[model samples]
Target: MQLPDPSSTRHPGPAPYLRIATEEAFAPPEMLEIYRRILSGANVDPGFRGLMGFYMSSPSERAQHIMRCLTDMDALRLKHMDDCGVDMQVLALTSPGVQVMDKATAVSFARIANDYLADAIRRHPTRFAGMIAVAPQDPQAAAKEIERGVSQLGMNAVVINSHTQGEYLSDTKFWDIFAAAEAHDAPIYLHPNSLPPGMYEPFMEAGLDGAIYGFGVETGLHALRIITAGVFDRFPKLRLILGHMGEALPFWAYRLDYMHRATVKSQRYDSVKPLRRQPSDYLRENVYITNSGVAWEPAIKFSQDFLGADRVLYAMDYPYQHAVDEVIALDGMTMSPEHKKRFFQTNAETVFKIPPR
Candidate 1:
């Protein structure tokens, strides 16, 4: 099949990065309808303008708005791949996963979401792959869903929001879900959703909130909690993915490392093993970062330097950022061709087990 030409248009640089993140494409119709209603003044919430402004000002706004119908999954995958110069995309259900629902409801939604995603991959094997959306609210059910998604659906990995409703992933109750993920050898993509209650009040007070502040703060803390909890020590082979430039973690790696190293009392957690290594070490070894909403040269280079090029992947954070602009931004960077290739494609392939084209 003939894929779309990425270089057809004249741009400042090589075509921007081809996005593979979940939110851009997998936004369920129901979610978009809710967003539309909110945007159209139906809800008129106090935070509506801030939310819309962020969405409109994102670098990949055009790509982010394209929602796929459940029945047209194959066409959507092909069209997205062609338009974005994406050779293969690892799919996952959009935000919050099935975590918000009760145990039974979460299990049902997860089966439906995974089945739908698997069907998309089945219809276009070379163009798409999938991640299981499990409900962390119930560990047993979450494990079952992970097993089903990986064994039956053939999903490559799992995608989860930083926290479920209000609970962070560090809780012991969620260990079964992690164990299943580790057993299946599927990485978990840690994307951010809304902040838990009271968490964003400080940002709200400053009038700089939502994705600009809240999302990063919330997700960063979540990632840190996993590191501090020594979850990686327990599941050393488990790979975790962070979107939007590691959700601000990369920029603060040095400080985090220093703080962790300099304070002895702080190092004493309830875990069996001590955090002998810096937080950045775990980030480099066990975690992967993506260039989603962030496209600046300095930020990308800094993240690559800290996490290594092999740990970075390209993401557009679609609907929130424009894919075209993201590609344009990366193309303009002065990074080596090999590094760029890894960021655009190879790293994701390795992490998600996507067969190379």
Candidate 2:
């Protein structure tokens, strides 16, 4: 999988409207050090060991370049955005961000990272918007941090890097985080992390534990778990943003609805609880999907058609999987000017509450 070089293509100048790229990621410098320390310690997550171990230690040009881009919230990132004609980027702390740390470390680092991002946004108000990073390791403290982020820091959304340790957000222990998100009306961007242990070893053995195929599998499962667990029924107003084309959920909507109904009716598993609506209903009504790392026109169009036009948005998946040519490809996608506007700009504005430029 060769990545596009932003330097290879000429900028297309301006577009019909502001181009806001959601799902962009940045890391505080110290976060890298923390990851390094974790990699050297015992009881390391196998998925993290596979993903970050490679990125943090590999000397390949791609690894080095991505590492450089990840820590830079300033010039280099801005340059790529400018070169790609992206008007704004909605930044979130990079994956496994403080999630693998202990409760005390996770809580404290989450606040520090949020403050770091808030300051960056303050400096580049028009260029950057941010999502709140919270530690689900301590849901109560996390809920308070979410409030502080939205109320005091002017952040637009909450970013949960899929799971904590090996636990998904569907568990009741993590509901406080959802409660906070719903109370503030802040969308939770359920970004992918490396797969959790037990389920991750096989994928890692095959070298599929990163973004290639494992991420969608892991994150899509997390989204479905929330739906099947009646999280939506519990907090009907909660909004979720799933990247990588809703982790391929739109394509499987009908199957999910059908199978979920069958499973619930049979009570096959104690956890297979009934819901007020079908699984896909929650997707249509409560979730938003982004074309992050997915540059194909047919897939993007299908996602919009299947999930409703307004529920689809654009994201660069910056630093990790971005290219100027990919931006050009998206620009040339066949859609009505109005729908295109929603896909590239307005949908993100609405979902993330991004202010107009």
Candidate 3:
């Protein structure tokens, strides 16, 4: 909650890099209604529903303020960006966004939500960018939305907040989205949602499912699912972005490769098919990781070195982890100006095809 002054980290001379936060978030009120209804009706544990119910209700001032932040794109947010020196924001829908809704609502509401974001970005192209929200509940419609969101609306990236219900992205049911994203050359941002229904029972009491630990586990598994399930093989040119430093995956890159080669080759899981490249290779080549809500420099350093600095990006994870101190810390990374430029600005330009600013 305490925000540091952005001016504290600046050098006496000009700024070193232009910061473009890739995981900036916003949620339309209409989308919130859909999530409330879906969560209430979902066949999950009762306790988890209770927690979601409380979260949906603004029980405390902090909760209320957070909700306000999600919907407001006024001068306050821009001031925060200016205070933190963030040049542009790739605004994606918040977690569980339309991902939890029923087919009809998800389809209709996602369009409305994305259209609002597009209009907002159009009003301020220099400071803000848009990311498409596609509801996987209906894959065909979702694919079309991807096409429209990219070509028609000029949104830079596609964002799906982790799984839909219990089904992950690797399932063949969602291939149309993968194909559309690849064709359009827009990277899909694989954000973290809460743990799928059944799994949340264990963590609901302590609230681990909402990003303390479960989000990383669930999202890391989702990315791994895509890699192992041949999603990348099917759409080799498709690119994916992961927040929280690849949801804690890059640190174990070698272990994943070693284990996959030793075990997958020897005793192939029925679920995992053959991959043209190893899991680590797909991660290095096709995946871009962002340091969102993850201020630890060691993780960023390791991710840049291991995944290649070209594959690493900067993000503030706004409204949730929007601490000014995090930005100051990231600006102080011990790397060359070129690597910092790539992390802050160039990687986003190349990935999102953002026009000259």
Give the number of the best model, judged by TM-score.
2
RMSD of each: 6.0, 1.7, 2.9
Give the 10-residue window scoring lowest on summed lDDT in candidate 3. Answer: 5-14
> lDDT order of candidates, best first?
2, 3, 1
How would you encode candidate 3's per-residue C-alpha lDDT over 1-357 as one tens digit per residue? 343453365432236667888998898877777666666574743533544455678569667767878888868778778877788888999877876666898899899999999888878889888899999999999999999998799986899988897888888888899998999888999998877776776876677767778889889999998998898888999999999999988888889888877776776577755668888898899999998888777888899989998999989888777666677766777889899899989988888888756
Count residue pairs with overlapping backbones in model 2: 0
**Whole-model Cα lDDT of every candidate shown, in order:** 0.70, 0.90, 0.83
lDDT of 1 at 223: 88
Candidate 1 residues 288-324, lDDT tens each? Answer: 8887777677888988888898988877664445345
Clashes of each: 11, 0, 0
Task: Estimate the TM-score for candidate 3.
Answer: 0.92
Better of 1 and 2 by TM-score: 2
TM-score for each candidate, following the candidate numbering: 0.81, 0.97, 0.92
CA shift of 83, model 1, Å: 3.5
Residues 1-357, candidate 2, lDDT per residue (tens digit)? 443455665665668978899999999999999999999999888888888889989999888988999999889999988888999999999998989898999999999999999999999999999999999999999999999999999986999999898898999989999999999999999999989886897887887888999999999999999998999999999999999999999899999988988888888899998789998899999999999998888888898888899999999998898688888878877889999999999998888788776
Model 2 ranges with Cα > 4 A deviation: 1-7
